[model samples]
Target: MSSNDYPLTTFLADHSIRPIFRLPVFEDWLFWLADRTGIQALFKCAPAHYSYSPGTIRRCTRHGIHFELDISTYHGWMIYYRRSGNRRVSDLVNRGDTVMDVGANIGEVTLLCAQKTGPDGLVIAFEPNPATFAQLSKMLALNPGLNCVLVNQALGSMTGPVTMVQPDNRNPGTCTIASSTTPGKALSANIPLTTLDQYIEEHPISRLNLIKLDVEGYELNVLQGAEKTISRYRPVLVIELVDSHQKRHGHSAADIVKFVLQHDYRVTDFSGQTPFGIHDHFEDCSLDITCVPNECVSR
Candidate 1:
């Protein structure tokens, strides 16, 4: 109970951590952690304070790619941790290959794909959020060596202005074009929308293959709009399937898997090289999955 408590002082002296406890920086960090992660606030980090002025940059050490992030938000935190969700997409990319990165967020993964595809290859990256798009553009500018075409449009089933709802300022990557009635609304933006099929028909690439979709739960619509592209190219499909998010859009993971199967493609988890069938229970439908056309399974 006293300042000279034998056991406590001895333990601190032995470990030499008393200076750490005495530092105001440590106290400040504790307070900030309590505020940021809500360790003691009984909730997650507050999402309202996620926005910051544009042009802030963070370098991802793992992938050696410089990403522009608004550190005042959730994505900024992800950058702090160097959170790379699925690097497996890079494995599927070959030199001189053409790739479509739908829902490219700040283009971190897109950067990796660009690197893999090399200068001769084409990397079409799309980000609908204006603020996030600015960040992606900044990254592209920082790395002039990357041959990427940054598109400020939402990839959907139609070519028009589409409204994407952002739940909050915390996570810019969560924006989706699905209707609000099904999944509640957030701050909305009217973005240019184009189907992959239409875009390919108009601006034909030398070889259209290897498409990655991380468009929240709007993968269904993008796929529907890309019917012709898929039928014609049969590119490897890398997609994220969130069951709850799909339900919010009035669909299910089963529907997405069914769509892939209907196209004569077999499903597999992102990390798994073995192919899965529609009837096979995926066990985890919440992560990125690979759907390859049966014809290419042996290749």
Candidate 2:
């Protein structure tokens, strides 16, 4: 039969393509087939490097706010938007609290915190990589209504100059610049660093409700830099602790636990499918370690 004369159902059946109703249960199967067969090429595509202009715009969602962002940084944008559940961190977030996202990394968590906190709450995101910061800044400009403050600086134990390295990958901003006792990889550049205490002192912050630190291997120094802030604000701290990454910087998971515990905070490992109950013992080797103030334990 001629293409125009063929019945739609017959064509789809002959092509072995399932109808949309069956998609929900087998979406992954379809994606896998498409990847293997290059069937995705049949769809219209945008340039991979496309980016959104730096300006304000309204995009609707189930949440109450609309945000602006560059298309190139869409991955980061999605991470913030799709977060769900009453995770320990989410509890404090629902109360319209302030958040600090060190090593903001394209501002995904930063944007998530912004949306959760609403207009009254504040989100201070620190990203030092020039390219990532560029996209992050553009996103901030796009969402002018959110109470977000962007700082292009690295967080470390002390305020001083440090080498900020950029990897050769597409997301060059993932490069880490903190000092390494054992050499592992080389980075693109070095940049000056600052302490979180200095940042809060410079800005008028009333309270710190949450803090997320993911500085590649520099997580320990970032926590140390914010010791004063942790003591005063007692914000819930979520940090990434890859053993290999920490070892490069002469740190370990145990050391991190000691540091947070010394500051009167209780550490919890939530890397499992089910949340650990009060009686459960937390494992020390988790990649993501979340800490809450001892006083806030029963809350």
Candidate 3:
């Protein structure tokens, strides 16, 4: 039977594939089969048009923000952020502020941040992976002359050359410096790394309102690299603290919490906290930990 005649799950089950390979393999197969069987048309799809690159940009109805992503895994995350009802970022962004998006994979969050910050504000996005950077460049080109600066370099504790592991061509987001945790014994390439402090010093940024840190498990290192900047600017830090990814990078969730806390920023979970310092219990995974400077909130 043709792939269009059956569901994706049915095709995988009929083939008797292993569980781990079933999802990704079926997804890849379904995309191809749907194209071949004319099922793509049923989904209101056009021929795979390479407008900017191979990825798609879907606009969210809830938030009126656009997400430029390649894989389906990110779609769910975008939807969650759009419909979260907690408009902390959106609110802060409306007041004429600049944001730094570290590890901006293909500029999805970067675009969102830029849109929120508006034309007067700036968005400094950093992406290390060469392939992903190329895609990000193409995607940014679609929006002629945005106030976003795309930097093709990784952030770290120190500024110098470092090895970057690129896992799969289709999945360039998995690229990291840590070799042990990389999937499938992937080949690595050497890339230059820089610290936020150095960049700010060279570029002369007046103010930093928000900073989003999602460097796989290397959030702490990126934070360390920005110690001077953090101390000087005291911007709100939204970091992703995944325990598993931290372990691979020779760190832990507690380490991230401690580091941010040391900067006089309290961890008030995902939900906003009261002035009395009572925190809401948010599950610890990859979360948007907001670090408001003591001075910013106290005043």
All candidates in order of lDDT, best leading: 1, 3, 2
lDDT, candidate 2, at 176: 82
Over the stretch 184-224, how does candidate 2's per-residue lDDT look in tens digits? 34543456688898888888689888888878778888888
Ranking by TM-score: 1, 3, 2
Q: What lDDT would candidate 2 get against the real structure?
A: 0.63
**Candidate 1's residue-wise lDDT over 1-299, tens digit each?**
33244443344433345335334475356446545743332111222224334434345444767655565566665654334455668888999999999999988778889999998898999898887898889888878899999998888887888777876546788888857544435445568899998888888887866999988788898999999899898999999988877767777887888899999997888876666666765443577788888998776
> After superposing candidate 2, which stretches have Cα over 4 Å from the reference?
1-92, 178-190, 271-286
Clashes of each: 0, 5, 0
Clashing pairs in 3: none
Best by lDDT: 1
Cα lDDT tens digits for candidate 3, 111-157: 66677777788999899877778878876776655689999888998
Of candidates 2 and 1, the better by lDDT: 1
Against the true structure, candidate 3 reaches a TM-score of: 0.70
Model 1, stretches more than 4 Å misplaced? 1-61, 182-186, 280-284
lDDT scores in order: 0.74, 0.63, 0.66
lDDT of 3 at 132: 73
